[model samples]
Target chain A: MDVRQLSEAVTEKTKVDTTARDVEKIISGLASSSHFWEIVCATQKPFSVVAEIIGALKEKGLVRVDQEGEITLTPQGQEFLKENFIAPRRDYTCPACEGRGIGLEKIKEWMQKFDELTVDRPKAIIDYDQGYITTASVMARVALMTERGDLEGKKLLVLGDDDLLSLAAGLTGMPKEIVVLEIDERLVNYINEKASMLSVPVKALKYDFRDKLPEQYVGYFDTFNTDPPETIEALEVCMTRGLSSLSGEGCAGYFGLTRTEASLKKWSQFQKMLLSKFKVAITDIIDNFNHYVNWDYLLGSIRDDYSFVQVKPKLNWYRSSMYRIETVSGFEKIENRPMPCELYVDEEALIYKPDKSR
Target chain B: MDVRQLSEAVTEKTKVDTTARDVEKIISGLASSSHFWEIVCATQKPFSVVAEIIGALKEKGLVRVDQEGEITLTPQGQEFLKENFIAPRRDYTCPACEGRGIGLEKIKEWMQKFDELTVDRPKAIIDYDQGYITTASVMARVALMTERGDLEGKKLLVLGDDDLLSLAAGLTGMPKEIVVLEIDERLVNYINEKASMLSVPVKALKYDFRDKLPEQYVGYFDTFNTDPPETIEALEVCMTRGLSSLSGEGCAGYFGLTRTEASLKKWSQFQKMLLSKFKVAITDIIDNFNHYVNWDYLLGSIRDDYSFVQVKPKLNWYRSSMYRIETVSGFEKIENRPMPCELYVDEEALIYKPDKSR
Candidate 1:
């Protein structure tokens, strides 16, 4: 079959946003690396969609998968790619900043100090779906905030402190005050101890976002940051809480969303919520900005049962793009209500399970 | 007045999102440069908002403006900045890529050819609000497309050819087809002449976006690109044209939006339309990605009447962030109808004048 016909068949079967060119690009990614995770990263597509694309290619006799599940393009696939002018995929993203367009040179000292302070921090707890980003990433976030004039005397809030972004912002000595609302008491106590010892203007309070925000925090903060669960319900609750805390009109919020757990449909829904329900303008969205270190529970989870992801990965495979949204005039204050237990698990979610205790 | 009180006052008076910290940031921006354009670029806020902030600062005795319009911090302003730990604003964005996280190294040869071909391109006419970006910016755009695998053997569409993006993409010897729908007859003839001479798979056709798209072109493209006039109505028309040309789900489109021309309220409204009406996912938004050469008519326009722009700018200051959106399941294509003359003129728009001929 021709390339366009094959791509059309794949799109029909998989029901994904796929083009003949993307089909060629996916095949080109497999030329150098048969590893599934590497191909996914190269394609910048969801693993589930990539898996289906490969299945269609195999059925078309353009690619083959051995018993070990290693993917390789067949002679027909190679010739098709050549005739279609599909060259080897090249990543030309800037080396210094990883395509975030911002680097960490200005905050080296603060980043070093943040690393030292959080070296003994708690590990990722699978129950909370908590996996923290690298300290350098946190520092990069601070540097961006500084560059955007969001730091230095701004009231900063962190809805979840597993990443310890509050401490990082506090270390810059830029913000007027940093408040962290973390559900994990362990993280809260840890942050409090460190803030007290270091004497930074930071405070940690234990509060689940599923509950109503305290009266004092309403319309009080200039910025809010969160890395919430990717489920629709979690995003609604978390984003609503972030909006409620803003003083109004130009208050900014930062959050992270991943393609691994959330489909593009969910992303569309989330953005719709932010724009219509919250009346906020999305200012920036840097792709793959937050690189997450693999947590301990990844290998033991349902992700292993997927048809792709053939081998155990030694690399940090999970990452989420960073998003910054700002209020223009005002935003709706979505009243907080107790969330159901199934707010974390959805059809596309891999590692999340219901936390019944809440 | 204290910093918080000053910020609150500024926010109240201007009805823009200003924080106590942002007031200090404005002051810090002024510490080194008194030029209005320089400060606006440094602070990355709207020009109108910055002008109001400076007015508030002057009222509060933190700054003074000379007859020539140079601004300087008062001793109390300096002291307030010092006491609040506000330092001189430093931009740590990566120097090489200018914080776009992508560079033009990969397409240097193609960029050179593009420049050589378009050396005698048409001058930007002010009535259509036409101003083209630098050649380097266009090359950087092509590189970003290459890195995203959107260029190779794809059916590409350019909604407007004033930027000559179709020619740039064509010179790469990629893309299965390139189509340009341009309102400017000069740009259309120029692009078609060059494409025929170069033997590139590109066609430029004169078409107004307010009219219905040609039936033959519907659902015929894999990707579309445009830099539309930043009015709410123009965005709707241009974006709908781009969407209607896409084959189906997984197609991508590129556009530009500038804060200088569109307010955050307009941005929020536009994003709402993109998400709800079109069902597209915003993948990336690189701030200040497209730097425009100062159009000849800028100094002769209403923008010169602003109080804060104390002196004429010698540097190129107009810029717009690049936006990339992709369809997921499917998108809605709004039918085109004849639009009004005021479609391009809005309260926030600075350079646009109605083209009566259309």
Candidate 2:
């Protein structure tokens, strides 16, 4: 019998016998079998050394080499090795939120600043140790577009191939075709393979997007969705291509980094680039796959008549509880009374409705 | 002129005149009015000190003290002190959860576990910073119970005269009479006064809950809610009384701290105390108002039939992806793949579904 068969036998019997001589005897018995040389070749070990190692492992009770020279793990051996031998080398931190988990809080604060932006519910962006892409991010994207009726048979192109955008494509139920253009050949093959298994007809293309798109596909898509890497020059090139390829009324959803004035300036430059092609309509800053990473969604229309593009901040957009109190009487005593008439030099400066009594 | 009027004048004119003397001239004109002395008295400041301080503030361009002692604010003055001034003090960090916002995350994880065991979404517990007795907290409690179909027409007896709970009674659409039992006579009066203004009828009783609930009101309520201070013995006693007063089919919810196995043994005596009185049908860890702090939710059900008790493990219940590989050998190169078979003998075994072809 072979090593695997002998191991199975020992496990089937009362318990795998772990004696050194017993394992050696089993190995010798298997060596005379018809497939003995093939098994030895597969293990890539010298026959005598393999025999000696098997015997030693058996004596230590790490493994049981049975009558057929088959090997199986002993419970103590498995536990001992697992506990003592292998240790995770790197500490896993959330990649998307940078382990801060403060993205949700930041999103809530941002919503308060703008009037037109509204989220359906509190969505969590989970970071599974090996880099996660959550369903919430996809659902949020779908919800936003669906609420505005933006995705009705539009041919959407996802420039960066990831589970997040793939799931978003599925959830959105729009985009006549989702063309996932991935630069890496291996990733493209993997995504295509997964798509086939999932029964989602996704076309994966391997091409470097930083350079010009293939001449064959220019102005070929309705919308562009990209989460570009954090390089200003690379982003500009990607944004330029994305905006140029869009049909007159198409919207380009770009995921860019946010947080300092420099990032905001980069985002503004992209907006200017879009305006050169189409009439700029509505602009929204949304939480990306990770809520902390803010992305800008710009919708432009060839015609000026679309209501979706004409969205504007509401009248009370700037009002906040921070300025609700008329006066801070002292650090300890915050007076919540109505603002006195004399408190405003210019009546038009009042953001909230004035109390008539005051 | 009073400091308040002077400050108001300063604030009103700051935009037009940025200099201190110009603002002081405006305040001086206002001080010439016959009502200046009356305004000073209303401000609750010593007249002499108020006048001297105004002059000092004017010299510093923090205020504008006019010839007649009236005051107005320059832009510089407004920057220095717009409404009132006080000595700066150190900011305090939240003692619980260490200001990291982990408290709510812990609570949500625990609550999901509780929900699984109880098959009920117990009202979310919120730590409203100062204490549980706040309007927002009460509103949140009532809203949660209402969502669970628990607060409709059932009488609610609030053990303490918390303003927020009283507000909840008024705002909750459920048609139920709310009774407030308070030990403090003044608090009882204040709640009654507010209840009357909102057109909600609430009866306040000067009684101690530590003693048995009044004999007249025994067995009269459907549910009891409390945000009592953290004391294990006190919670046990209150829970006993609350359970006793609950209707035969009614349920009781209690919130408190969670204990790990190591710490739980020390509180084993309390477990026995709870088990003796009520059948703790479900124990859930919940997120209070703060999502980071894990709070234990003990849901005890009163029944005439068999008693049931369940302890739920804290789980971070968020959506995650699960992969099922059809053929393990095809994906063996993948780092996270589960091994198809064990080679070592007698290892704490995972039953392998061997490849039929192999």
CA lDDT of each prediction against the hidden true structure: 0.77, 0.36
lDDT tens digits, residues A131-184, model 2? Answer: 123333434344333322234354666675543355345433444566777655
Write candidate 1's Cα lDDT for B1-358 as tens digits: 6766766675565445455546666777988788877787776665666777788778878888887777888998788777876677868787767777776565568778988999999999965678998887787888787777777778998987788899999988888899999888999999999999999999999988887788888888888999988777789888888888888776788988887767677788899987888878898888888878877765565444445564666556778898999887646555655555445455455334323233
Candidate 1 error regions (>4 Å): A1-25, A55-61, A65-70, A80-88, A303-308, A332-337, A351-358, B1-28, B52-61, B66-69, B79-88, B303-310, B332-337, B341-343, B351-358
Runs in model 2 lying further than 4 Å from the true structure: A1-134, A137-358, B1-134, B254-276, B282-285, B290-358
Per-residue lDDT of candidate 1, residues A1-358 (tens digit): 6667766676575444455555666887987678777787777665656776787778888888876667888999888778867767767777777777776565678878988998899999877778998766888888887776677778988998899998898877789999999999999999999999889999999998888888899889889999988778788888888888988766789998887667677788888877778778999988878878778776565444445554665566678888999887646565655554445555555334423233
Docking class of 2: incorrect
- TM for every model, in the order presented, reads 0.89, 0.26
Docking class of 1: medium
Compute the lDDT of residue A215 as modeled in candidate 1. 81
Q: State how far residue B249 of model 1 sits from its true place (Å).
A: 0.9
In model 2, what lDDT does residue A28 have?
Answer: 32
